[model samples]
Target: MPNPPRLRATALTATAVLLCPLLAGCGGDDPKDPDLTAQKLSWKDCPAPSAPEGGGAAPSPLPNGGRWQCATMKAPRDWSDPKAGTIDVALIRVRASGGKSQRIGSLIFNFGGPGGSGVTGLPAFADDFAELRTRYDLVSFDPRGVGRSAAVECKNAKQLDTYLQVDMTPDDAAEERKLLDGTESFNAACEKNSGAMLPHVRTTDAARDMDLMRQVLGDRKLYYFGISYGTELGGVYAHLFPKNVGRAVFDAVVDPTQNPEQGSLGQAKGFQLALDNYARNCVSMAEGCPVGDTPQDVKNRIAVLLKNLDAKPIPGIPPRKLTQSLATDGILQALYSQELWKYLTQGLYQAYQGDGKVLMLLADSLNGRNENGEYSNLIPANVAISCADDKPRYTVKDVTAKLPEFRAASPLFGDTLAWEMLSCSDWAVPGAAYHPNVSAPGAAPILVIGNTGDPATPYEGASRMVKALGKGVGIELTYKGQGHGAYISGNKCVRNAVDAYLLQGKTPAPGTVCS
Candidate 1:
């Protein structure tokens, strides 16, 4: 997989700004030292995101003129061995807009990716949470091995461009070998470039960092908004520090009950469902669908296009070609949000006419490639964190055996996602668990919102997360809608439910349904 499971938030735009360098503190502090928590932070005006942070300008001032502040917190490089060394955890925040008396504490957000840069992500979506900003300081960060926090480096830009183009789905022995070799090469590059950091980027370690962050931020409890993979991190945090959770919301929930294989399979079905929805919606439009006559016809055309591209690639953004993999990835990226359907339609139309630029652009976004052709550390960090968290490493034989089931689930996405099982096969570090432990019995009630049409993380994950979180702790809310997340969909019901809980501590009734 060229990309790991990531949030489908707005695309981050790149711009010029001053660079804020991370000054690594002198290491070798006492393992049991308590001074780190008491260390004061010198917050300053935000700077442009580093190359690893998808390179972007400093966050703009909030509507209320509250400037974004940037800071770095020192955390143990390895939670298991705190005395070893330390790494900087990058953070960004905007203070509450309302008066001091009305302020709750900081509400930290982790917008998924396991690799998404909160320092950049928060700014892009700040307006979406303007209401919450009235009472709580909006906070977010780049977890370790992500963005500028000891970012994991693998292949360079040129090599990455090549790597992403490799045929992910193998039809025969030679192709399977090539796939395996490519995966192994990628993993080896990670080990060569960032071996030490690889073993320490697990979700559990990140959860501990959050607790330390709570102490550093002077918050009595952790009030959090976690999306996509962020929800998994939140669950682990709740499990580790149940008493410290204040108010938490998990949108686009990841099922904690499944292993990596199961998760990938679930995604196959989810994406297929989203595609079906997209096709049906397109045909139902008053202007008539430009892509096809019927929903099945649309899908059939796409399948034919992918098959044709597999045999002979089409010209994309020049020098690069739109291979079957890129087109498939582009299609999956579009499925993340209903709003992107028009683009998908356009991309498909363009591809049919032998121009792959639009589809290639969509694929580029999914791969974290910028217009400059430089990549963010998204792919590296995602693979690093995922490998460190998951244990199972599938072999080619395993994937071959499961192909039929995957295909049945999603003929469009099956082979690619099934082959993605090999992502961790050659990792340097052993994974922490088959699946995360998220049974927080006494934790604060966390609002769990599920979007029925969410492609990346299926709706079924919400109830599974609820059950896994144990009784009375997870309040499930269903949004019968399209897209990857509920709150950002601009749905009043979801927004109100989430806002009321986060802003007023008034939890929505359990089993609430929003449309």
Candidate 2:
């Protein structure tokens, strides 16, 4: 989602940097129910889920032999031309526990991937909806080009391994060529495998699908809880159909004003911050903490390990070696949440002892790579969707020239993310219009959640979104906590703020900070 190049490691925690890319709009339309044709949805018992975390990369499919009911809704591939073709968008619904009398509305949920499968991830948040269960039928879907929907599949697991292992920090023309060739190859794989849908899966198109879902559900307005890249989709929906908005909370805001590189650079800084945080904690603990005696010491050790692995990838599992890329990926995965820092500590200890298997496995887990090397399509879908939505403002030459700044952002992760920006430079399809500005002019007050110590989206981005949104005119709720997102990380203050906003149509005062 936020990390367009999914292979790039996100240190500190999980889910990558979606809070870093997703947006808002104005109001002019009259307030009345939308009168549009609605489609009927077939309901049945839901199926079981293959994996809850989606291996941190792709959304695992719903279990073929499980409990959750599943259904399909069709939308024209090209909304502009309904005659062109059709694609299926998958949906999973948890009917309100309360009788119809208690039902307030239908709340649509999106778990930030730009590529992450909302349908596959439906169950995890089933509990998040616990309080709203009686009042809302919580529904989530795999946006086009993901999960049970028409997915974007590029390299298979093995080929993906080949592509990901390519050196991100290229020092010579040969390395640069290898990096470009890998990008070209991965892009070509996507083109070859997912060409048809690639052209149609723009964020705007997905927003249109949301409108259709709203109409089909027989609702005049939309109630949504969007996280990370989901914020992108939600923000876009608000802009496109500002009048259709109901109660919405965009937790972990993504500054839609930022282009790909700027967002990535910001994320680089966030990861650096997370790394420093982790290092400080690790050093303070001393024993069993492999990072070192001080934050600088920890940082240098990490750089040394990456350099060593880059020169010589150590043996990992039988077939998979721990390359610099995988090692970095493992590190980044830990950065997504503070909870994973312990695992990072253990992995680093093993890695320092010459056993990279632990770190490599950690990387695999984040990328949704199963033990058998069966990779999930999350990365492929992420690339496809992100490329469709964004085109780099800088040329490949420009990106390379900007390396110093990227490096200056985070010595541990700078180039890894910088090189990743090249994927769209030679994308198979041209991207949509560039600028995304969301001032949500006439819409009801919207809540933008920001974690003060968030490593992915960063706190200032939230403040920026609110300012563009006209400040309290476009509200912001702060979580003075650590991690990529605050709402779902057991922070009652953040959760209550979100609940109050969605359930009671309440907005916290501007600059309200929750610890």
Candidate 3:
């Protein structure tokens, strides 16, 4: 399951028939680069990412009959001004093994993260979509300012250490100031280092980029598989190009209707439910459990642990100490999947024993920190794109005002999720108006999948998405399971349904449930 990216403020494609009408602006006369049109990609051998020391090379995620090769495409920095400037788009494709006889065109993917790197993530998808790849080119790209694409630069790894451990639950004026200061400092670094790309990275622009990808890739129609934030992109694309949306699948759906604060409230409750599920399992274990006999008791114990950390952080893993903020992130990360709950339990157990290394490691994994103490640009890119797409949020004072309301919504995680979003207030650019309404009236039926116990994008949002896209073209499938993403979960029925939709534009009747 993809980790839910920490929230903030603000923040693909094609070919053949000039498939995107809206991407070129109204009447399709926004701008032009005749030279950029009709260019075919020159695919080359895939570049290998660095592997861990003594661990040898990481196995390629490419499935049988597929060989990975990559290409670069030039996209307009501002679609409205094709001549103003351009950005290099990094793309990876695994050509269909069925050859020309059975080819169905390219199937693009966006694995959430408003910041997840497509090139680095392609292999796992390649393996998962192996069956579909037999008849389609499996394609994905890091959106502008992300991953292999020109990344959004911000704080250095060492410089970012202290920020992660700040007290996010800030119990007093001084603690709140520290939290605000840390986010403000991080924002300043991003603006100073990545100002140029920030404005151009909005979701609307990214949607336009998808159309450019389609035109260049030679696909007359857009076919995609988007999870989490990818759903946000795909949903926007559908609104813009309803007629061009061929077959799109969005799982672990993130609702666009909710404002920033509402989004946080919903997610906090989602994680709280997931944590309760983890707690239930933990309490039932044969040996001693870290907390108490029930979920509330577990939460009480967690409160004590976080309170203690705020008073005195454990000196952990040389050069980095365990702070309450990092510990909260660590716990949040584990809440994504039950498979990782074991690690959360272990981390909590170790923490209670006066060591914070395990949870710190989990936070590092969620933040994309490497074993070498170096960090990926995931956090920076996530913030950049999110701030560009979302509505502006409250400051420390404003957020504090909403604490009572949020706390009532999620007693365990309300504060952190709400305050973490304050980072958006320091964004370098303004956001597009929040999309409270999303409907693709003329688009093909879009399948919206949700995991009942998902920690990040909760089940209710899936129902909301279905209602918003309710013009007889939205299909909702439910997974009664525990995890962040259902498609990748261990449910055969869910997998088959997803595969069927992607392969044949077929969706089971709405309200289909799989356990």
TM-score of each: 0.95, 0.90, 0.91
Residue 347 CA error for candidate 1 (Å)? 0.4
Give each model's whole-structure lDDT: 0.85, 0.72, 0.73
Per-residue lDDT tens digits of candidate 1, residues 1-515?
44343422222221111111100112212225486788677799999989998885677787679899999999999877777888999999999999899999999999888777888888887888999999999999999998889999999999999988889877889888887888889999999999988888988888888888888999989999998888888998888888889999999998889888999899999999999999999999999998999999999999999999999999999999999989998888788878778989999999999999989888888777887888889888888888888888888889889999999999988999988888877789988788998888889999999999988889999999999999999999999999888898899999999999999999999999998
RMSD of each: 4.4, 4.6, 5.8
1-515 in candidate 2: lDDT tens per residue? Answer: 11246532222112432221122223333223232234577877655433322443322322332235567787878866766667888887776776788777889988776667676556655655577666788888888887767888788777877776788778898988777778778888889988988988888778878888887877878988888777667777777776788988877777777787787888899889989999888878836456577788888988999999989998887777898888998888777788778878888878888888878877776666666666667787778877877755345687788899999998889988887787775788776655465666567677888887777677787777767665334688888887777877888887787777777777778778899
User: Model 3 — TM-score against the truth?
Assistant: 0.91
Off by over 4 Å in 2: 1-4, 7-36, 48-67, 286-288, 470-473
Positional deviation of 214 in candidate 3, in angstroms? 1.4
- Give the candidates in order of lDDT, highest first: 1, 3, 2
- Give one digit per residue, the lDDT tens place, for model 3 in 1-515: 01123531111110000011111123222225766766677888766542210011332535354678888888888766778878888888888888898888998988777776666665654555677787789898888888656678888877767567667777888877777777778888889998988888877777777877887888888898888878878887777777778888888888767777778888878888888898888888988576677777888898898878878988667767787777887787777777777888888888888899888877776676655776667788888787777766567778878888778777777877777668776677876665534677777899999889987888888888877775777799999999777876658898899878877767888999999
The TM-score ranking, best first, is 1, 3, 2
Candidate 1 clash pair list? none
Best by TM-score: 1
Cα lDDT for residue 247, model 3? 89
Clashes of 2: 30
Instruction: Quote the lDDT for 215 in model 1.
Output: 83
